[model samples]
Target: MNKISFMLNGEKVSLYVEPNDLLLDVLRDKLGDKSPKYGCGRGDCGTCTVLLNGKSVRSCLILAIEVDGQEIMTLEGLSKNGLTDLQKYFIKHSSFQCGFCAPGMIVTLDEFLKKNPKPDEEEVKEAISGNLCRCTGYVPIIRAVMDYVKNRGG
Candidate 1:
């Protein structure tokens, strides 16, 4: 096992990981982070999305050892102080159906909005393009995000 050190959920963490262990496995199996689920396990599905250094990434595509000294932000970190206004909007609009993709959707938008708070509808759709939701359609999700952008901040 390889010893790796990184920040998780706003806290510093160090743990052992196999050489080929995926970040999703390390996060879920070892660190007890459940937001990044095991979807396609090939990075095609955004259900395992996480924020690495403020950028959204597929945790399943990352090696645990590669995160040494890096900062990893999951939904746990995002909700440390309770849900944000955008999260409320998501619930208000019922952006999730099975909720499998909700974590990634929220993580993606959290990062995207930080960069482009005033994104247009098309831009909003494009922002979450990588995250696919098999349950709820995109219209409600887009509306929720757009509402958050227009009223919350952007």
Candidate 2:
């Protein structure tokens, strides 16, 4: 096993990981980070999304060893301080139903908002297109993000 060290949720963390072990597995199994759920193991599903060096990526598709010296941010990290504005907006808009996609959608949007603080409705829809939520039909999710952006002066 190769030892890998990376910044997780603004904290430095190191652990032994096999070259073939997926980042999602290491985070959930070894590190006990349960936010990045194992939905579709393939990259098609965004349920395993996480931020890698401030960018959204599918943790399931990345090898743990590849994150050595990198930075990862999961929903657990994003909410470490408490409910972020986006999260509050989500709650206000009732964005989620089953909530399985909440973490990935939130994480993905967190990065997107940082990149494009002022995004149109279509842009917000496109940003969360990868995350599939069978319930809520995505209308509420879009509204929540748009509202958050507007409230943030974007």
Give the root-mean-square deviation of each candidate in angstroms: 0.8, 0.7
> Any idea what lDDT model 2 has?
0.94
What overall lDDT goes with each candidate model?
A: 0.91, 0.94
Q: lDDT per residue, candidate 1, 1-154, as tens digits? A: 9888999988999998889999999999999999999999888879999999999999999999999999999999999999978889999998888889989999999999999989999989899999989888888899999888878757
Cα error of candidate 1 at position 139, Å: 1.1
What global local distance difference test value does model 1 have?
Answer: 0.91
In candidate 2, position 104 carries an lDDT of 97
Estimated TM-score for each candidate: 0.97, 0.98
Q: How many steric clashes does model 2 contain?
A: 0
lDDT of 2 by residue, 1-154 (tens): 9999999999999989888999999999999999999999998879999999999999999999999999999999999999888999999999988899999999999999889999999999899889989999999999888888888899
**Model 1: CA > 4 A from native:** none
Q: What is residue 54's positional error in candidate 2, in angstroms?
A: 0.6
